[model samples]
Target: MTSADARDAGDAEAFPTVQLDLPVPTNVRVRTAEFVKSSVEISQCPKEGPPEFAVIGRSNVGKSSLINMLTGRKALAQVSKEPGKTQCINHFIINDSWYLVDMPGYGYAKRSKDQRREFDAFTKAYFKQRGTLAMVLLLVDGSIPPQPADLDYAAWLASAGVPFSIVFTKADKKKKGGPRALSNVAAFKRALLEARGFPLVPPSVVTSAATGDGKSELLAFVASLRGMWEAAKKRR
Candidate 1:
């Protein structure tokens, strides 16, 4: 069988549950997922309100692959070999329950100045203004040490008071039986801790689209956040 087929077969079996160390329950399952809409601006996004979790990262960080893996849909989010292909805010409604938003990749040096400015403005506005936004899933390449752009974005999100979680992608790319990915994750966390001058760190997960590692945990994390969002909405 092809590798993709193997990954699919593996997903069919029971996988280990993701331990978030949070009080939220992680029993939720995704029964159905459908592409809802793609919008250039957050204002153009779907009006039917559901708690939305957005995924973003530097260019070519495997954000699309991770999204597809988490939802068990191969082509749901177009996986491109080229970086910066996703220039719009793409929304996928999951089980008619919540929205999975795919935001444009940042830190591509080839992008025009105007394009970068546009993305910056829109991204900042979405984070600052989107009331239904539950959390941001920030994907980072796990095979290498932390990049400055990722660190800067994390700091920016913290300053903006935006809720987010770190997802280390491409774990399968790490050397066989090596701890390079884990070491990178640790270094990134230390940088964040040092930069923020605090002991608390954002929730994080390690993932690989090829082997379906951390798929269950990532989904469980989303499920827990969605539950919290629903409860908060009811209280209001």
Candidate 2:
């Protein structure tokens, strides 16, 4: 196996990527955002209901802040200064129609061996078993190049045939022309492209909780996927 392969599955396309790059992205009209519950296991998750879009990433990727910005709520999701502060599957009911899941940070969080094992077991189960899982918003640090933890986990998603999109966070910390973030995004796409099983780049959105940039695009993407998910359910 090559370096990229060993680092990630880079396998062939097992499933078609979702077309989320809509020509005209729609703005998300969030009417209500409410905290529901937190679960540490898949069995404890709420009964199958509305489509769920899970937000996941490494520690300190500003997942909470992003969630707040997206929902137009100041503190719907708890924001923590310490990495890995969240260690449960947090569910937020949005617009009283769908769910926004705040997943625990995977990599770069200091945890005991047992804690890491628990995360690996339950998180993967949630991804594989959750019936209402629509799309996972995979968060990555826009300030730096792709980290191995991010790439490897992305590779796992590809191998598992899970539906997800790349979300570059903290877009406000960039240069005049945003060279650093641009370069980092480019590098991440390139890495995924080179992976064996991975197909073309998945949909990507750059967002900044501070400046509220790319919020519309991200919402539009979510709206598009939500529509698709709903249609699929109807067909079933």
Residues 1-236 of candidate 2 have per-residue lDDT tens digits of 64432332332233244454443433367888999999987878889899999988888898888899999898889898888877899999988988999988886547887887788778778988887899888999877777888898888887887788889998777523343233566667777767544667787887899889888878877887777776677899
* C-alpha lDDT of residue 107 in model 1: 86
Model 1 residue 124 distance off true place after TM-score fit, in angstroms: 1.7
In order, candidate lDDTs are 0.80, 0.79
How far in Å is the alpha carbon of 55 misplaced in model 2? 0.7
- Give the C-alpha miss distance for residue 173 in model 1, angstroms: 0.8
Q: Model 1 compared with the native: what TM-score?
A: 0.85
Per-residue lDDT tens digits for candidate 1, residues 173-218, read 8433253233566667766767655356677888999999998888
